[model samples]
Target: MSSIIPGTQNALTAWQPFNGARLSVTSKTSGVSSSLPNSLQVQIPKVVSGPIGFENTGYWGIKVQSGWTYQGSFYAKSTSFSESVVVSLKSTRGTVFASKAVMGISTSWTKFTFEFQPSASADTDENVFNVAVDGKAAAGQTIFFSMFSLFPPTFRGRENGMRIDLAEALAATQPSIWRFGISVATRWKWNETIGRLEDRPGRPNTDGLGLLEYLNWVEDLGAEPILGVWDGISTANYSDLSTWTVVPEADLQPYVDDVLNELEFIVGDAKTTEGGKLRASLGRTEPYALKYIEIGNEDQFQPESYAAYRWNAFVTAIGAKYPDFEFIATTLPSTALTPAYQRIDFHMYNSPSWFTANAFMFDDYPRNGTKWFIGEYAVTSTNDTNTLGDIPSGRLPYPTLQGSAAEAAFMTGMERNSDVVFASAYAPSFQHIRNYQWTPDIMTYDASRVVKSTSYYVQQLFSTNRGTHVLDTTPVSSNDTAPLFWVASYNNETDVVFLKVSNTGSQDLVANIFLGFTATDFATATAISTPALSPISGLFNVSNTLEEPELIIPVATSFALPFSDRFNYTFPATSVTVIALQSTTALEV
Candidate 1:
């Protein structure tokens, strides 16, 4: 498990031998690093007619595509063998996609690497990777395999890198921030992933997806990292109140020092700090950027300890060294703390209507002090109503077009108050189609496909069309209770006007963008909504799923018009629209 790549299925848990092969996968204590305590042992029977070995259907089935060269490595040894071993990838019907002949397997354990390209693409993800030996030659032999791995072309082609398709889908979002989703706990250790492939000392887990891999991933995506440091807070159970773990404030200095070490590894010079030296030894010479450091997540659950000392202990220690870096608090903001905090991380999960109604949530927030980090926000089927038998009967498994439209309304408000709302994101970003949490994710993916939710497209629409200045605009309604919402901004460098508008109402509304100055008459408009032909009853029900991922997505169109300072665009019913007006002549808003 220690040597397995981020996207590769590991060890011998998923491998099964071919029929008539006499080999059972299990642990052996004689080989490899101390971190990896187990090795797979295979036993071969005498008088076998065919090859004897193991087959791996990677994470269900390997998606064997043409023109992809898979890099695979393994450590193997046999008590007796007379011929070179064979490793191949093939379909269920014996369609050999790729094969490699590895030689020189002796009594001692030796590592080997192979690069093989499939002859053609497999129609479906029903392919398997096999490791076999000539049954006639080594009929009565015992073999041991450990730390085996196979990886397709990765993001930036880095070894042990992220999968190509999944990374591409996320990269398409044009994200500005990335977090590894590792938070506070003893299990959320970062040091377990750095030193070496097989000796990182991951207790019961792999060190593959560790600090370096995540940093590389963030760098590849062209995003900044939101480093979440453990703040000595953990709970054994959410419903039980007696099992929480809160390290005393006096005993938090060691953990605080560990955080400083982690920060130094990411931002210190190679010649200056021990952590930086370790990073340099691992091939990262120049330090990575460090800006946002979240002290803890949801510390509001333990407000007493957090407000009393937990927050101050870490902040004081970390701030003494890195004063410029912003510290985000997991609890509510207050002007009372001695060592001031910069931002408060907020999370919200509610029904679609609740989000739509609170679209102007930040309109009344004071902009004089601490800003906000919308750590998580999403629309769910259930509400805050404490009704009896409150189990959600028909929870929304995915983001619906309706819920996303409402969310876009809320996003417009957030953008209008960008000065106060520092950074925002749709939480629970991605999940496996088969295995996931309770909340609906922005992305649902399998081995072969990725479904970007309507909310994801909404976020992409906003992120990709961001502006430099938040221009003031008059309300579209005569009264303040209108269902339409919008925020206008101007990009100084690009000379473009970006208007993100959402029509939560059923009726289409034509709102004029009074651009205060002259600009191009034509603009590009993109929107995600239910088709015009769809019944109004099903407008909010339209969603992307595993069976139909593209059910509703942003469609772009550009057209010419005769206008200078202003333009009128119709906001579609229950939809989100992002309009970009690029100017030929200079236009100051």
Candidate 2:
């Protein structure tokens, strides 16, 4: 288990391959084994005068703290009898803190253990763990190595684990739910991700983010998982985009079976079903955390007739077995609503101006149909001048303060109408910087560091400070050109009122907040503001920026007239402000 809170490190794990590990070899030739699976074979043609170092490429964001010991080990075998290998943890500058020598290496696998405690506190994201050959080796002498595991006390101290710093950063956000397997929806098959890690086929662009790992991440975060099952649709032609369609019934039935079994594996316990039994073998005896099972990913590309047929078939089959589970349709069904289809997904990727203007997009939406799930949404504005057209081109835009403020404005609308919008999540939630395709990601990170975008802070603010119910608030006066967006929600349990306000204009404006209820006295008021007009550092790009002024910083400038029932505050230009008011008087039951 990780020491960090669960669900926080959703993007920590990656495929552990020799190349991916970024091993640096010197005076020794090393390559992955072809005959022996998961083994790295090293051969020294001639012994060098100095120690031949085989250092890891140092991409694993390992943080070495003073007085903290890290226990690690690896399996090694040498062709020559009684040959020894020296293992040590070293800083990027080649300063060794700890070392261990293993003797009596034979043909069979032998585990070698070592412990390292940094002499001084250092966060060496590019540091390497090295295994150096001390002495000369005969011509063509071979050494086999496998399962090179190193764990620096993880978040919850899970055996094979996550980086603590990254985990801590994510847990701070307090995400309520996680939606997984959406980007790879067309290619992802649930069965391919279960069982042993090595046995599963690798996902394209994703560094081995299997189903079990995803579930464990969600479980760690204490958040629910929304699984996006693959819709049994295949594309026949690449040039002709219209060639994609649902597979034949014979093939579709097997795909449906796979999805059903996946559900069983998730929600079933011991003695429940075959998938459940397999789940038990994987160490989870009880059902894992799963609530919403999305039928497909953006299924609107396929013919409407076939898409409807596929949706009906999947819903009918899954609903029959797990009647309690709620199913989310990828697109609005062409036909009438079915009991199985509890929600419909809505995706939006528009400009910053468009998002701010359409803050109340869902206000007029009919409540007679399926509920709304903002499954994927982000403001797709680019910093590059060439990419300013209707579509994206050139370098993508970093998550700017302007974009985040616009999103915050839109989110206030969503919260005000939370009854209609059941759940929402930002798209491209996790992106490995080296292998990312989309831009303006919520969180971006390289092998060594994780950088939360401005959009992430906005999401975090809303998720952490959510209220029990919406409260109607009327603004005394507002300019139509320089619109001031605000939403108020009350937490009855805590006797606190949360007012989120966004100002998207050049000049500041004063607004009087009217709750329109019984008389109440304000106890204390604090506001968190993200002002877009504030000058930011030039180096503050999407991948290397922190939240300015922090997400929930204090605001000491609010006035309540001595004998009045109103509170007044100045809204800064191009800013997102969240105000929390604690009332002195109690509410009437």
TM-score of each: 0.92, 0.82
| lDDT, candidate 2, 408-462, per-residue tens | 7788778877888888988676666656667768776665566777677777777
With candidate 2 superimposed using the best TM-score fit, by how many Å does residue 14's alpha carbon deviate from the native?
Answer: 13
Off by over 4 Å in 1: 1-12, 20-28, 184-186, 201-206, 335-338, 382-394, 476-481, 534-538, 583-589
237-271, model 1: which lDDT tens digit per residue? 55554577988878988888888888888888898
Residue 174 lDDT, candidate 1, scale 0-100: 93
In model 2, which regions exceed 4 Å deviation?
Answer: 1-38, 60-62, 67-73, 109-115, 137-139, 183-186, 189-209, 234-246, 303-308, 336-340, 382-391, 394-397, 432-435, 475-482, 518-564, 585-589
Candidate 2: C-alpha lDDT: 0.64
